[model samples]
Every structure is written in C-alpha cells, then in structure tokens.
Target: MQRFVHGFLLLPRCSLLALGGALDALDAANATLGHAQHSSLCLSLDGRPVRCSTGTKVQVDHGLADAPELQSLFILADLPLPDAARDGHARQLHPWLQERARYGMLLGGIGSGAAVLAQAGLLDGHRATLAWAQVPQLGDSHPAVLWSSRVYEIDRQRLSCGAGTASLDLLIAWLGRLHGERLAQALVGHFGLDRLRGADERQPSPVQARIGTGGAKLAEAVALMEANLGEPLPTEEIARLAGVSRRQLERLFKQHLDALPSRYYAELRLMRARRLLQQTGQSILQIGLACGFASGSHFSSAYRSRFGHTPREARSQRALAWRDEPDQPPSADSGRTESPP
Candidate 1:
C-alpha cells in the first residue's frame, strides 16, 4: 500500500489550533493503526519556522518549491486573514499550487486558507466555505468559488472548513473516507469529541453577539430588513412592525450600530446586490432590480460608490481565472480506494 502522505502548507500567523488539531488527529490515527501508513509534513514559503497566531513558532519540513509529492495538502491560516499572506507571498504560491492541482493533488484549506486558494483561483466552481465572517468578503472578491456558510465543504477532491475545531472535523472526516469509519471513530474516542460533525452543519453565526446586545427592538428591525432585502420595507413600516416609532428606531440604530435606519437598510440591499453580481451569472440589470435598485445607472453608481467598482467590472474581474486547471484528476488517482498499508 502507498503511504498516505499529507502536507500542511502553513502561512504567517496561521491558526495554531487548526494546524495542531489536524496534526494531532493524524498522529492519533497513525497510533491507532499501529503502523506508519499515514505521514504528515509542514511546508512554509521559505522553509523556516513560522510565527503563528499566538506567536508560537512552527518549524517547517520543506519550502513550497521543495515540497514532496503528496496525496493531500491543506493550507491553514488565521481568521480575518492578515495582509502579509495575500500580498507578494501569494503570488509565489499561486503557480506552485496550480502545478500541484495539475498532477492530481487533493487540496484543502482551513480558516482563511480557503480565501488563499480562492485567490489562487484553485477553488473556482468548487463549493467551499471558510470562517463565516470571511464569506461576504470572499463573495465580493473570489466570487468564482462557490462560497457557502456551512462548517465544511468537500467538493470532489477539494476539502475546506471554517476556522478552529472545524479543521479537526474536516481531516477526521476525510480520514474516514480514505481509510474506514472504524479508524475515524477511534480518533473521535481518542480526542473525546461529542460526535463527528457533518458537512451540512453551519458555523456559529458571528453576528449573534451583536444581535444579543442590540436590544429586542433593534434586532427585530434588523430581522425585518434582512427578510425584506429584495423588496425592502420603508423604515416607518419596519419601526411599526417592531412595535416602535420611526424616531425610536432611528435612535436605536444610532445608539447600537452608529448608522441611521435608512442608511443601514440601503447598505444591506447593496451588499446583497454585490453578492448576486459576483456569485451568480445574473444580468446586471436583473440583479439591480432584484436588489431594489430601480435603474441600472442607480445600481451602477451605488455599487461603484460602495464597492469602488461597477457590477460589470466585478463580474468581469472574477472571470473564472481558476478554470485553467482540469476540474477533476485523472481516473488513475481519483475516487480509488487505497489498500490499507
């Protein structure tokens, strides 16, 4: 049996928890197997120890250029991706990652690592999710990738998950798929997990904290805005539905969110419009109407004012840049069950 070689491509300020979880899971799985069938390595851009999220330095086994051919590789980064990873460093990563994909490598991303892959154009047309907070920004940017709010997504050979323990779930689930459920179950016991989570589960909403403290009336008004985004309700009607006067609504928003009710509401509509423009193949005019803009010019001006780009440019810029690679690996390596070593 071929040894299952896994590579972890670590970025600066990478999530220590995420990287540790995946490494420990692999270690435990190897221990349970009583064989060295599974192996892991850490890669860095320059083959040096990386200062991770908590300032702990993680040593690397290889630089990107010298990385050994592996069965799988995962890019792990911290949430709210730091600027350094996406700048000149990412330009170096893109072509190397593209080459790996060309030869049947299984790629995964944890936390904002998914964004890295999307930036490299590797996740285009592939369903993927990152930490939920990163989704909107990703929708506006790498709209070619089918971004989701789910805790994890496995589209064909590509794997991805939200930050933190979600990375554990992704690796463990993939372990089960590659080996057997018995091995996966043993690791769950080893780690004392509640239960193995599934692909459909969504990460906890990051907005819960704000909503909890924004007061009931404010939350109600926001809920109404969210539900009526396509056909937005007037602030007066929203206030009335929330059992508050329009004056009180304005006060509540200003107090908690620092934006007027109408301004907040318009921003929401525009955000939805931007997502539709980037994430879907919708016509610009149709998207404008759907997002409550009455005219193309109004939509264009609003979109440019908010996102600093027109809807056409937003769609055109994203131009399926990742489609250069074949969507699936050859049959020789794809979906073939490995004989246990």
Candidate 2:
C-alpha cells in the first residue's frame, strides 16, 4: 500500500484546539483506511516538549533539523508571531522553514502559523487564510500574501486554515485528495459533523451569528458597526442603514444580545482594539485611533474598564510570558524513526 508522512511543526503557545482538531481528522482518516496510509509526526523547532496556549505540554518526536522526509509539513502557531522583530531564534526559523519549502515539501500553516509563514517570506504570492482575529495584522504585515477571510484555503502546495474546527476542514480536504472522496465522507460522518464546509466558505463574523437570520436589521446594524470601527457610526445612522428606527434597533439588540445598541457598538470597537493589541505590532496609540478612540488615555481607560487591565499591562504580561518560556535545544537525532510501511 502507498503511504505518506505528514509533519506538524508545533510552535510555542500553539492552540491546543487547532492541533487536536487537525490530529483527530488525520486519525480518523487513518482508521477509515484501516491502516497507516497517512502517518503523522509532531515536531518542534527543537525536539522538545512545547506548551500550548492553554498550558498543555506536547512532547514532540523530532526537531526540525532531524525531521524525516515528509510529503507535507504544517506549522502550528496560535499566538502572536512571538515578536519576531526582537527574537533572534524566531528570525532564524524563517529561513530554515524556507529551505524546507524549497525542498518541495507541501507547506501549510494553522491559525497564526500563517503569520509565521508570512514572516518567513514563504507565503508571498500565495493565497492563505488565518484566524479571523489575525487577518488585519497579517494583511498589513504581508501585503504580498493574498489573505482571505475564508475558513481555510488550499493554494497549490500551500495550505492554511483558521483556528479550531477549521483545521479539521483543511485536513479532511487534504485527506480527500490523498485517499478518495468516499473515505473523506466516511471520516466526516464518523466525526459527527453535519457537513464539510468548502474552502470558499467564509467564516461568519461573531456578530453575524449572534444576531441570527431572524434579526436581519440587527445583523445589518452590526455589520455597519464593524465597517465603521475606525470612525464609529452613530446609533441613528446605523438604524437608518439597517432600515429601522433607533428605538427599534435598540429593542433588537436588547432582546437578542441583552445589551443596548450603543453599548454593543462600544464593546465591538473595544474587542477590535484588543485583537489588534494582541495580534499586531501596532502601538497602543495607533490601535486606539484605529478603534475610534480619541486619545491613548481614553482608549486605555475604556480598555481597562472592559478588560480589567490597561493596554500596557496586557502587552507587558505577554512579553513576560514569552520571556519566561524555556529555550530547549534540538535533541540529538536518534536512530529510531517511524516511516510508512
């Protein structure tokens, strides 16, 4: 029987949900095939255990330098791109990854892993998708990459997907290509998924689902609010765009979201600002301005009230957490290896 090996390059602070979802899909595919048609190996930059964003430690089998030949490799990183501008190790990993790609291995990323690939210059001229929260920053940082809001994308040898269950979608599609549509269908059904979403399917924004189809006007207002994050539209203006009176808009929000329209809009803008703060290298002032705050102080105050921490505090905590991460060197290559039979 033909066999393939797929590598997962797990980064520090990767999303456990995304990693598990992708692995589960592959496991299902293998079970459906009744053999190890698709074998998987977890690797780190250095062959060591890496802690995920949720504090789960995963012991990897190989380091990048010692990785066995593989059909495809996925970079899995869920957090911010580890401030590559300041970290020398991060800088080095890029070229190392580029060399792997040059060797004709199918390169892919999960969640913010696309950000890492973009930083490595591997995603240039490639259409890719990332977690929705990271989309704006990745677009700004890597204009050469054709970034999409879709759940996942497969462009040539490059594959990418948003975080969480979207990883299942990406892997299932890949499994379909490798085995057959019949096995893929069986795997999806086994996972209890209602249906497999196509690559072209866009991820619905948070507000879109919160408002639901019953509240078309509310959804429209939310969409308008999202579009006007930089320059917030007045509630009256949002109501007008949604073809409803301000009172009706207010009623809809209170009924569905349990919040007033103005409050919901403010929260939305604040949430956008928080994501930019966490995901982008943008300055607090710039993020504040981008999120419709008049000044840094105003933004900080609002952010503190909403998130219970100042923007500087949030950023400082992230930096501290990164600094506290242990740097494990690559393990010496052991003769023991798992290859397809």
Candidate 3:
C-alpha cells in the first residue's frame, strides 16, 4: 500500500470542528483501505500546543522548522480572518510556506487558513473559497484572488474549504482522487454521512431556515428580500412576487416570526449590517448604504434601537475585543483549554 504524510499546520484559535472532522475522515479512509495509507502530523510554528476556538488544546508533534518532508500540508485556521491578518501570524510563516510550495508539496487550507496562503501570494489569481462570513473581509483584503462562496475549491495543488463539515467533504474528495471512488464511498458510509456535497455547491443561506416552515410564499418573499439587500424592494412588489397581498405577507410574518413584515425585513437588513460591522473593515456609512439605510443618521438610529448601541460603538467594541485577546492561556477556572508549550 502507498503511504503519505499529511501535515496539519495548526494556527492558534483554529476551529476544533474543522480539525477533528478532517482528521476523522482521514482515519476512516485508513481503516477502509485496510492499511495506513495516510498519516497526519499536527504542527505549530514553534512546536507549541495551540488552543482551538472551542478551547480544546491540540498538542503538536513538531514545529514547521523541525518538521520532516511532507507530501501535503493542510492549514487548519478557522478563526476570524481579520484577527489573523492583524496579528501578523501568517506573515511570520509566509517565507517557510513559500519554500514548501516550491518543493512541490500540495497545499490546502481550511477556513481562514486560505487567508494565510493569500498573504503568502500563493493564492493570487487562484480561485478559492472560504467561510461566507469572512468573504467580505478577505475579498477586500485580497482583491487579486478570486473568492467564491462555494463550500470548497481545488485549483491544481491548492485545496481550500470554508471549514465545518465542508472539511470532511474536501477530504473525501481527495481520498477519491488518491485511492478510488469505491474507497471514498466506503469511507462516507463508515462516517454515516448522508452524501458528499460537491465542491461547487454554494453554502445554504441562513434565511432559508428562518422562513422554511412559514410557507412557500413567505420563504420566496424572504429570499427575494435577501437578494435585494442593497436596494430593498417595496412590500407590495415582494407580495406580488410571492403571489400574495401585502396584508397577507404581513400576516405571515407576524404568525411565523412573531414580527410584522416591515419589522422582520428591517431586522434582516440590520443583522446583515451587524455582520459587516463585525467581519469587514468597511466604513460605517458604506455598510449602512449597503444595507439600504437612507442615511448615516437614520442607520445609526435604527441600529441603536435594534442592538442598543450605535454602529460606531459596535465597531469599537470589536476592535477592543480583538486587541484585548491574547493568544496566551486563559485562567484555569475560565474553562478554556490550553496546553503548555
């Protein structure tokens, strides 16, 4: 049986779900193959243990500088992309990563790990995908890279996914390429996965779940509203599209969501604005305009009413949170897991 070593470069605050899911898939593949066809090593920059976003501490086998040769290197980085960029962690690793790429080792990134590859200029002109929440941030930061909303993407030797169970899908597809479709199918069955999602499949919108059980008309109206966030449609137009009267649409929202149609729509737009505030570096005015607010004052007033804080305050709090968060261990009583270096 052929053997290969896969290196997982664990960044601080990486997503435990992404790391575990990918490793679990590989474990299943090894069992299905009836041999150790794939081996994985966890590594950090300085051979230190790293804490995941869920507070699980992952012990590393080696640091990048001390690691042996690798057939493939997958970066497990599922934290906020903006934090990764601001912390300069990827910049420190960029030179070594570029060297490894030159040596022909296949590179893959899970979640915001794609940001590191982009920082190293490896993803420039390459089509890649990342978590939808990070799209605006990373897309704005790396304009040269083609960012898609797909669950996963593979361009030549580069592989990337938006994290979560998507990591498993990417791994399963890679297993198929490495072994065969039969073995991949066996692993999928072993893992009890319903079916493998294709790499090009777009991530499901959260609004779908919100309006799914309301009614077809309500769901269609909500979808239309989501698609037109920048320029909100009139209630009458939305009702017309859903084949319902405006009064009926308002009744549906009140019945299903316990809110009026206008209120629900405003909440949706405000939620979007909040995401942009937390995730992207766009100006407050720009975000307000993008969310269909008529003016900055109007946006601030509505935002304060919904969230109990002005937009600037929200942004400031995020900045302070990011600044105050240290990569070091939390207190033992804090319930956050961390391992000593």
Candidate 4:
C-alpha cells in the first residue's frame, strides 16, 4: 500500500501554497527516506493553474473531488476565509469535510485556511487556532469553535497552523511522526533547516495568552481540565486551582464565558469528546470517560445540546465522507495523529 500526502488548493485563482515552507518540509521527508515514502498531489478548486500569494503560478493535476485517497490533505488558502466563502467553494467543500471523520483521515488548515475549515463547519466544537488578525472574526462567527491565539493547534483530526514559517514546523512535525526523528532530521537537513524543531514547537514570536478576566480564568481552568481529564477533580478543587472560591468561579464564568462553571465545564468536556469521536475509533463509553463525562448518556446529552447534533451523528458524518480506500490511507490522517511533545 502506498501512503501519501495531499495538498488541496482551496483558493480559486488567487492564493498559492507556502511553496518554500511546505514543499521544503516535504522534500526533506523524501530525501531522508530516499525516493519518497509519501507522495504529494495538488488538487485545485477547478483543476487548473493557480497563482500563489506571491504571484507564482502552479499547476494542479486534479480537482479536489477527483483526487485519490491521501494520508493527509492540507487546505492552503491565502487571504481571509471570507474570500473563499464569497466564491461559493466553502459551501461545496464543507459537506465533503463533514464526512472526513468516518474514514479515519485528518484535515489540515494552513494559514488563513482555518477560516475555510470554520466555514465548512469542521472547526465547531474543536479547539482551533488561526492568524491573529482573523481571530476576532473567527470568534465572532463561530462561537462554538474555541479560538486559540497560538500559532497552531491540533484538536483531533483537524490541524490548523498559522501563516509563514510556522507552516514549515507544522509539516515537519507531521513528517517526523510517520518516519521518525531520524527521517525528519534528514528531511530538515535536505531542506537546509539549520534549526530543525519538533512539531510541538511554537513560533518565534509570542502570541497574547490573555483574553479577558473570564477568558483568562477559562484558559487556566481548561489547562487544569486537560491535565486532569483522565482523572477529573471536583468542581471545588478546580476552583481552588484557578485561585478563586467556588462561588467566585461561578460568578467569573457568568461574567466572561456567559455560562456557569458546570455548564462551561460540560461544554469543554463535550468539545474534547467530539475530538475523540472523530479522531479515534474509541468506543463511546470509553470516549465519554476519557473526556470526563460521568457516563455515555451524560456525554451524549451535552454533545447534542452544544452542537445540536448527537455524538454519533457527528462521528457518522465524518466516517461516511472521508473513508480510506483499500489502496491507501486517507490524506487527512497526517495532521490528526501526531502526539503533542
């Protein structure tokens, strides 16, 4: 079986792939392993040559719908996602992605492409990051998708990395997962990356971590929750961890996050559950427990309330659309499975 990496040019005749960053990383992967363990294909919206954000035109051999099974698919969209949205591509592509979870594949949004994923409904209930300037827009439009100011985030099967050199690290981190550090090093060496960093590496510039009093508290609480998702702490204990009394925690949430502590916590848990549902083939009971829900029924009820869809509905949506063929692993898998370092 031949494993592959796929790049989908989501922009019409406009934005180009971060040719140097993305291609260089992939080239390193090929050089380290001799020939290429991973093959790449460029699927354009219309199967035509499109210009890069820098005005370089590249030819794409197939349309997204006609592309073969890939281990990963990178949505390379320059500019704001609204540009893609205006072109009617967002509507067409959203349905395709909604089904990606079923096939056990992953989807990646590079640079402004995060907006495309958001527009497609893939980022809802997922912790996603985007270019800083677009963060407000994303937050305003998709209140359900948690907005992170980080350079990149991989919440389950969906990976969204910000623009520029960060993309190099994103792809390199992904390559490292499949071929091991040795191969990733060789690829980085081949590409002249003097400082080869791991996938979990952050950008050179620091992004603001604080949102508001509520946002800050929520963030701290989320960190605590993630660290203890396996063995959940009591609400009062979590309040203590956040340096507030239980009543204070509730008040802060109502003021900032617009929900009570337990309600917000349940939403966070359901968000995590959604990731597990789409990324792993874990059983529902197992996923519920892992995400800190008391039982499957509890998890399902909360998931349905927040997403307005059942956990099974969300899982089946992904399963039906992005399934792998006997010939190959689906492309989206590359962005989904790399463990955080």
Q: Pick the candidate with the highest TM-score.
A: 3
Model 2 has an lDDT value of 0.82
TM-score attained by model 3: 0.77
**Model 3 lDDT vs. the true structure?**
0.81
Q: RMSD in angstroms, candidate 3?
A: 5.9
- lDDT tens string, model 1, 1-341? 76988999988888899998998988988899898888999998666688888899998998766676688889998644434333444445766677778877899999888887887788989999988756755765676889988889989879999878988998889888878999899989999998899888767563445757548788778767866666779888999999999999999889888999999989888888866765556789978887778899999999999999998888877675534534532322222222221
Per-candidate TM vs. native? 0.66, 0.76, 0.77, 0.55
Better of 1 and 2 by TM-score: 2
If the candidates were sorted by their TM-score against the true structure, best first, what order would they fall in? Answer: 3, 2, 1, 4
Better candidate number, 1 or 2, judged by lDDT: 2
Candidate 2: list runs displaced more than 4 Å. Answer: 83-89, 204-217, 231-245, 274-280, 283-285, 292-341
lDDT of each: 0.80, 0.82, 0.81, 0.66
TM-score of 1: 0.66
Residue-level lDDT tens digits of model 4 in 196-256: 6543443332211434332566567656664565567788999899887889878766766
lDDT of 3 by residue, 1-341 (tens): 56889999998778889998889989998888888888999998667799888888889998776677788899988645424344343335776778878877788999788988988899998888878767655766688999987888888889999877889989999888888999888988888888888877876556556666448788788777866777889999999999999999999888777988778789888988998898778999989998899999999999999999999999999999978987754323332222321
State which candidate, 1 or 4, has the greater lDDT. Answer: 1
The local distance difference test score of model 4 is 0.66
